[model samples]
Target: MNITVFCSAYSLDDRYSAPAAEFARLLGTGGHTLVWGGSNAGLMGLLADQVKAAGGKLVGIQVELLKHKTYPGADELVLTRDLAERKAQLLARADAIVVLVGGLGTLDEITEVLELKKHGLHDKPVVLLDTEGFYTGMRVQLERMDAEGFLPRPLDQLIAFAETPAEVFTHLTTA
Candidate 1:
């Protein structure tokens, strides 16, 4: 499977990094490919390394403006004119989506994907790997939206939540 990972562009604490590496290793060993933001820093770099070490393919998508900041590990590197194009490419290429701890950019990626799914643009599985209760608030907010009738579908149908990497696979398979 081609798993597009939405993650932080900056390095995070070991709490996030360790699990991310392990997740990458699992993806590699499981014969899954990684599609991600094209950069050689932070959790992105760590993941690239782990996947590569385990013989997995890395496909990176980056915008031209950030060309200088890209990493060297991608087996395939695709450049986009801008962020929107980059995101479109990411969404188009992914078989499944895994969202990990990140800031605004990551949130943007996951939200747009969810909205697209809600609109029937795609039916790919979207899983949240929320290590250490990181996404508890997001889960609550989603429930609130469902309660208020803002959600077009049940929260479970829109997004799968997993507190651990192992659970992420289960959600993915069953999503």
Candidate 2:
């Protein structure tokens, strides 16, 4: 399967990178493909390296403005006209989506994907890797949304949550 991973573009803590590396290793060895942002920094770079080390395919979607940050070893690099185009490609190509700890951009990706799924635009499984309880606040907010009747369907139908790599992969395979 082609798993699109949305993770931190920049991170100073090894807490996040360690699991990301392990997840990548499992992804590669398990015969899954990885699609991500094209950057050699933070969790993105760490995960990409592990995937290559394990001999898995890596597809990078990069925007023209961020060309300077592109990672060199991706199996294939796709250049996009802008961020919107890059995001479109990422969503269009993935069989499932895994979100790791990240900042604002990651949140944007998650919300957009969830919105897409909520609207029945896609049935792809979306899992959030709640590494270190990073998504605690967001989870609470989602629950609130559901309770308030703001969602068209149950939150569980729109997204899945995994606290470990094992759970993430399991959800992907069974999704």
Candidate 3:
């Protein structure tokens, strides 16, 4: 299945590069095509680079407004007029969504996935990869929403978690 993975594009900072590359390698090896933000910043470029190195098919979506002069993570670039168009195209192409550790942009990407699933626009699985327990707090926060009745108990199933790269692949296969 085509996997649309959302991640931060902050820069090639060591703090984010290693983890992102780890999963990118595994996802590619697992035979899941990768689609992500087309940027050479932060973990975005690193992940795409690793996937390409592993002989995986990668499809990157770029927006005219967000063009970085040089895209860091794209091989097959699909340029759109704006961010909104790019997001729509990405969501349309992907079978599932995997989120790596990232900031606001990453969060926003998967939020669209959640909203889409909530509205019955799609029924694809969404994964929150919790490498090194990075997403523990966030998971707890989601649980709080369930407890407060803002989120349906079963809606929590929309988001799945994984610890290592192997686990992420396992979920993709079993999903």
What residue pairs clash in candidate 1, if any at all? none
lDDT at position 116, candidate 3 = 74
Q: Give the per-residue lDDT digits (tens) of candidate 2, residues 33-142.
A: 89999888888888899999997889999899988989999989999999788888999989999999999988898899899889999988999999889999999999
lDDT of 1 by residue, 63-89 (tens): 999888787979999999999999999
Q: Write the per-residue lDDT of candidate 3 for residues 1-175, one digit (tens) a residue.
A: 7889888877655645677788888877777678887776668778888888876778888778777643654557888998778889889889888888888877778888887777778888787888667778878887787678776436556777877667777776787
Error of 3 at 120 (Å): 1.7
lDDT of 1: 0.90
Cα TM-score per model: 0.97, 0.97, 0.89
Q: After superposition, how far is residue 150 of candidate 1 from its true place, in Å?
A: 0.5
| Worst-scoring 10-residue span by lDDT in model 3 | 66-75
| Local distance difference test scores for all models | 0.90, 0.90, 0.78
